[model samples]
Target: MRPRKPALRPGKPMVRRGVPVGSPFRLLLLGASFALTGYAGVRLLADDWFAVAVWFVGAALLHDLVLLPLYAVADRSVVRGLDATGHRDRALYVRVPAALSGLLLLVWFPLISGRVERRYRLGTGLSPDGFLARWLLITAVLFGAAALLLALRLRRATKQRPPATH
Candidate 1:
């Protein structure tokens, strides 16, 4: 007598466990954004915490409407430059600047405000000199810190990824 091996199915759907990587992240992100918008709308309707509500809206607009476009342009320009010239270290020219800009916005605004009171110039709602200097100093410090972090990260990454064949 011959023993039969386990019968194999010709077609079977592979069962996957846990949340699919991208769908859950996308859902979570969208859900959080919706919640934030809902809260903001509720605040606006109530009109009790109007100033804070307005500021939140302004921040969101600044990021989504203004900052995003600027970054997209900058990213395209940097990538074009890298591609055109065939630069060896592409990330240095792109990610470093972006990271520094992010850090500057995150840290500089708060830190620099403590050093000097924001003075409004006559007539104009916003002036370049005060805004530029504060941001410039912040960005410079941020750039230096970002560069250091980048070097460390690059070193770590290099250690982890095996060398590729030509």
Candidate 2:
């Protein structure tokens, strides 16, 4: 005789064919996301599909071949430096701002560097000359804010420490 399956208890996920089914709300969100993705794919393919395909492939290759290794090395170096200085726990203070600044730089490189100033001006009737300065200012603000938060955390930590015996 075949062995009987165990009964499912309340709050436990339902199992079907060796797979666990997610909650109804999670499944609904998943289905909605799939539908949205399908709609976007159809719309994109209807337009200049070749350009989109090329952009996607080029982005993937660039990220895998160049960006990934460069960032990985940089991150490892930062972590190693922090660990050496006994500030490993403070690494996130540097990382978060740097990552945000890097993302902003990546997204606005042409404009930030003034390389697309003329084209941008002609297309949008607005000068793109301040992008570089604005980007620098924003980066400075991000780093400054991160430093302030780290200082506050350090102060709080020191205050909570037990008194040391002589």
Candidate 3:
């Protein structure tokens, strides 16, 4: 039997035209493209993609294998360290990434080299200093500028605030 089509009636609700793509087909196409891109990226990057991939994989492995415990231990250590009779800074965690990334960039200054030759490094994924270190350093410098601007605004706000009532 042939499929029946919806009838168009002028007075009743207007019949909708068929979509160029239905949700399922679009989703399948999207998933296939995603897979294709990943495959191409792996092929093009070959050994170098290994570093980023391995970093992510190592992060997962470490998180599963070691970091969870380490995190718990560190969290305990931090709670113990605040020796605060009661004073605690709520924004500390928010600032930690920006702060540590800056220190790391400084420490790994050599890795921040943007020389054209560094393009070769991407394919090999092997950086004497490591991709994370370099990317973090670059990101630190760029985003840290934004962080610094925030700090400056905070400083200015503090200076501008009215003195506490006596």
Index of the highest-lDDT prediction? 2
lDDT of each: 0.66, 0.87, 0.61
Higher-ranked by lDDT: 1 or 2: 2
Q: For each candidate, give its TM-score against the true structure.
A: 0.39, 0.65, 0.30
RMSD of 3: 13.3
Top TM-score prediction, candidate number? 2
Q: Give a tens-digit lDDT track for model 3, residues 12-37.
A: 33324764333555567788999998
**31-108: candidate 2 lDDT, tens digit per residue:** 999999889988887888898878878899989999999998898899999999999988899899999999999999
**In candidate 1, what are the lDDT values of residues 1-166, reduced to their tens digit?**
5658544344322435664343455567888999998987786767557677678788999989998898778777877777788764654645676667776666666444544334433435555356557677766776677767868877888888888821
Rank list by TM-score:
2, 1, 3
Who is ahead in TM-score, 2 or 3?
2
**TM-score of candidate 3 on Cα atoms, chains taken together:** 0.30
Give model 1's TM-score versus the native structure. Answer: 0.39
What's every prediction's RMSD, in angstroms?
13.4, 7.7, 13.3
* Count of backbone collisions in candidate 2: 0
Q: Give the TM-score of candidate 2.
A: 0.65
